[model samples]
Target: MKLAVLATGNIANKVTQTLVQIKELECYAVASRELSKAQQFKERFGFKKAYGSYEEMVCDPEVELVYITSPHSHHFEHMKLCIEHGKNVICEKAFTVNAAQAREIKSLAQEHKVFVTEAIWTRYMPSRSIINKVLSDGLIGDVKAITANLCYNVCHRNRVSNPTLAGGALLDVGVYCINFALMHLGSDIREIHSTWQKIDTGVDGMNTISIQYNDGRLANLTSAITAKSDRQGIVYGTKGYMVITNINNPSLIRVFDYDDKLIKSVEVPPQISGYEYEFIESVKAIGEGRIESWSMPLTDSIEVMTIMDQIRAQWGLRYPME
Candidate 1:
């Protein structure tokens, strides 16, 4: 599969580093607003071609898949651009600013009959299935609640503090916590209670959310851009509990009994950069003539975006683009 990246940002750099290690994918093209940046990325990663503009790269008929590494604010525009050009897209997390934009992108992708999926890497990791198997096998009998926290001291970065860029802790880090809960608990949410503290830029600097499920289960989640957190996801159950090392990219899963006796510890499988799974899945899906990935389907993407939209509504937070 020929792969093209649409940005020369930090994420693009990291993912490209892993792409060169994947034999199934070609580091075909990279585009940036500035040609020099794209050229540098091309030289650094050995990409076949570099484009000065996104439009120019997407215009290339040989580009099979375009990985979008733009900010949360530009996801809709970038995805739409790819889909309109009859190209398959794998966009970075937060899919869109809101559910409305997500739905619109979905409609456009369907109209174009192209493959499109969100690049939420956790959903596609092998550890996801391992965690699910543990829960399914009654290792955590009758799951009752979940607690996940993912935080980073990144407010100094413009993209993490700028409202116009749809920058905030929620979209950048909170989305992972939300996905962690939904991935394990299932999305039968009954009520959502949330609170947030804003930074000087009027974006959410820190936020806490409590989700009530229809089955009487609860998810207590927290995310912040101003401070650092342990980045753990704990699932409590009647028989025992499991502690996930890192919710962002789960490194290990440890199961225990009610007596706090450690039952088992499972380490995540080895990988290039823990990001190769999304690209691998996208390639498989496109080869199978599928429009969405089974790992992170469009419906799951929209549900997550909707939940964030509700949370923002509670705090009366709206991005400039929204």
Candidate 2:
């Protein structure tokens, strides 16, 4: 599969390194607004070609898949470009600025018969199923609550502080906490409440969200771009609790009883930066002529975005793009 990356940013660099490690996918092309930056990325990642603009890259006949690593606010526009060109897309998380844009792109992809999916990565990781199995096997007994926190000191970055770019902790990292809760606790949310602190840019800098599911389960989630956190996710149950060391890229899962006694620890399978799974899955879906990955379906993406929209609405926060 020939993969074209849409940006020359840090994430594009990281994901490209992992793409080269996969035998089936080729880092065929890269694109940036400036030709020189694209050329630099091409040389650094050994891409077969580099284009000065995304328009040029997507027009390539050999580019079957376009991985969009652009900013959150630009995802809708970039994805539309790819789908319009009849190219499959693997868009980064926070799929769009809002649920409206998400629905539009989803409809466009289906109309074009192009395989478009969100690159939420965690949904495709091996740890997802491993944790599911542990829960289903009665090891954790009856699941009740979930707690996840993901934070980093990223306020210094322009993309993290600019509302025009959909800058915020919720869309950037808080989405992971929401994804974590939905993945394990299910999304039949009964009630939602949150408190958020905004930065000078008018985007959320820190947020604490609480969700109540129809099953009476509760989730306490927090995300911040102004500070650092332990980045842990815990699934609490009647009998025991499971701890996921890093909700973003789970490397280890630990289980403990109500007495706080250690029960078991499981290490995730070795990975090539933990991004190969999503790309591999996207390639497989495209090969099978599927418009979405079974793991991270378009509906799931829409649901997650809708949840974020509701959260933002509650906080009276709206991005400039929206």
RMSD of each: 0.7, 0.8
**After TM-score superposition, what is the CA distance of residue 277 in candidate 2 from its true location, in Å?**
0.5
**What 10-residue stretch in candidate 2 is worst by lDDT?**
313-322
Clashes of 2: 0
**Candidate 1 error regions (>4 Å):** none
lDDT tens string, model 2, 229-314? Answer: 99999999999999999999999999999899989899999898999999999999899999999899998999999999999999
**TM-score to native of every candidate shown:** 0.99, 0.99
lDDT of each candidate versus the true structure: 0.94, 0.94
In candidate 2, which residue ranges exceed 4 Å CA deviation? none
Q: Would you give me the overall lDDT of model 2?
A: 0.94
